[model samples]
Target: MTARIGVVTFPGSLDDRDTQRAIRVAGAEPVALWHKDKDLKQVDAVVLCGGFSYGDYLRAGAIARFSPVMDTLIDQAKAGLPVLGICNGFQILTEAHLLPGGMLGNDHLHFICRDQKLRVENAGTAWTSDYSAGQEIHIPLKNMDGRYVADPRTLDELEAEGRVAFRYLDVNPNGSLNDIAGITNAAGNVVGLMPHPEHAVEPLIGTGRTDGLPFFTSILKKLVNA
Candidate 1:
């Protein structure tokens, strides 16, 4: 059976369509999941795409974290369901405590959008298994609150457990400690990042650099071969 990947749409989601397109391009069925829905529709995996959910009012992802779907997502993720959170989705993951740390405003105090260089520090995670360890890729990143902050103990634990999935390669745009860009949960099923991978999956796009395509492809491959 073809793998079904769910792309969630919150009230203010901006990249739900793009994420669904990327999943379809990767040979998976893209299922549109509503924020209020309790059923996952049996999607093999889920992608929480980027956007200013809930108008980003209280904070980037504060309100969106309480969405009803996230309640199910949090539970399923603990049971090893594959979950990928990108950009504002990453913010939601942190806010929901699915992932450690929190996102703060950009250290530069401005919204940043650029093709960012990131090293795949941990290729064993569910969302990044297609990449090789230490491999570098350039992907589009855009956000106002992209800086990842964690306590010293949390940082040390992540580093020690090899849970740091990606790191800034050349320059840290938001001054994320240790140049962290992405991380995974202990089971490797939940992954979160501040970059916009769905935007970088198409070749016809700028630079024709489809560096982020691997993320979608990896999940499909994992599901198909399971």
Candidate 2:
């Protein structure tokens, strides 16, 4: 069975097409979802790709949290629909309260872009099953407000519950608490991360590594086997 995944495109989304290509490369159909629409196109899963949605002027992903598409996306996500949010998409997830924490400007006060190393801390999430716990991988990372922050109580809860799905390696690029690069919802169906996995899916691309392909493949496998 072929899984159809929806990729939401906000007005200022920069990586929608690339994410769509990655979905196709994973042997799934990519469904383009517009910001003004609430219908999900009956997709089995959804991805909110990296971008400066609605122009990150007032804060990344703040405006996108209210998009018509997100109305349904939020509801469906709560019902166990698999969702993966990357970069600004991660910011949106926090705003929507689908995931914990908010993003702040990098501690260095500058946008950083490079191939980043990450350690998979929880490989059981819907988007991470193809990887093993403690596995290390490289993916492209680029962001301005990328530092993840949360209340101390929330951080303790997440750590205790194994919700921290990935952590920065080599360097904590954004000074996020606990070196968090990604996290998952308690249900393991929703995930948010800062790195651009879609960019590293093909070996001929960025770092000549396909470390990110497993994300798309993992979701496809989950949906097909379910």
Candidate 3:
């Protein structure tokens, strides 16, 4: 059966449509989910694409975490549902406590946009199995608040548990601790990343690279085999 993946769209969401397109390209069905809706529509997986949800007025994802959609998403995610958060979505995951740590403004205090290279650190997560550990891939990243920070203990725990899913390669654009670009939960069912893989999925679009296609493909494979 084809996997049905849901893309949540909050107010001001800029990448929801692109995320849907990428999901379609991956040979899966893309289901549009609304932030105000409490239902998940039985999607096999969920992807929170980038954008300034809630206008980023209240410390990025702070306000959106309290949305009705997140109420269900948080509970379902803890129950082993696969979820991927990109950029602003990553911020929401952290704010929702589905993922650890939190995002801060760019260390430079400026919004950044770039084609970023990252190394896959953990390929066992539901969202990253299509990548190999240590494999380098480029994905477009753009955000005002992108720095990832955590306490020393949590940082050590993440490193020891192999939960640091992706690390920035070449240059650290956001001054994130240890150059972390993405991370997965201990269960590996939830992941949060600062890059925009949906933007890199189509070869004819921005960056013109299909490196991000694997993220969608990997989830499809996991769901189909489940």
Candidate 4:
């Protein structure tokens, strides 16, 4: 059966449509899921696309964490449902406590937008199974509050547990502690990242690079072979 992936749209979502298109291009069915809706529509997976949800009010993703849909998502994620959060979506995951750590303002105190180089540190997660460990890829990353920070103990645990999925390859753009770019939960079902993979899936658009296609494709392959 073809995999059905849900792309959520919050009040101020900017990449929902782009994410939906990328899902289709990745050979999966794109199911549009509203932030208020509590149903997953039986999607095989879920993608929380980037954008300034709730206008970044009350500290980015702080307000949207209590949405009705999140109530179900949190429970489902703990039960092994695969969920991918990109950019602001990453903020939401952290806010919901699905992913650990916090994203503060960029170290430079300015909004940043550019193609970023990332090293795939852990490919064991449901969303990154297609990538090889230590593989490098370029994807677009744009956000004002993208610096990832965690207490010393949590940081040590993440590194020791192999939970750090992606790390900034070159100059760490946001001064994230340890150059962390993305991480997965202990169960490997939940993942959150700062870059925009949906924006890099199509070779004809943006930077003309399709390095991000593996994220969607990896999930599809897993669901199909399961």
TM-score of each: 0.98, 0.99, 0.99, 0.98
TM-score of 4: 0.98
lDDT of 2: 0.96
Scanning candidate 2 in windows of ten residues, the lowest lDDT window is 51-60
Regions of model 3 farther than 4 Å from truth: none
| Over 4 Å off, model 1 | none
lDDT of 4 by residue, 1-226 (tens): 6999999999999999999998899899999999999998999899998999999998889988899999999999999999999999999999999999999999999999999999999998999999999899999999999999999999999999999999998689998999999999999989999999999998888778998999999888888888
Model 3 poorest ten-residue lDDT run:
200-209
For each candidate, the alpha-carbon lDDT, in order, equals 0.92, 0.96, 0.94, 0.93
lDDT of 2 by residue, 80-115 (tens): 999999999999999999998899999999999999
The C-alpha local distance difference test score for the whole of candidate 4 amounts to 0.93
lDDT of 3 by residue, 1-226 (tens): 7999999999989999999999999999999999999999999899998999989987889888898999999999999999999998999999998889999999999999999999999999999999999899998999999999999999999999999999999999989999999999999999999999999888898788899999999999999998
> Residue 226 deviation, candidate 4, in Å?
1.4
- Model 2 lDDT, residue 81, Cα: 97
Tens-digit lDDT track of model 1 for 1-226: 7999999999999999999998888888999999999889988899998999998899888998888898898899889999999998999999999999999999999999989999999999878989999999999989999999999999999999999999998899998998999999999999999988888888899447889989998998898889
Worst 10 residues of 1 by lDDT: 199-208
Candidate 1: residue 157 Cα off by (Å): 0.6
- Local lDDT at 116 for model 4: 93
- In model 1, the clashing pairs are none
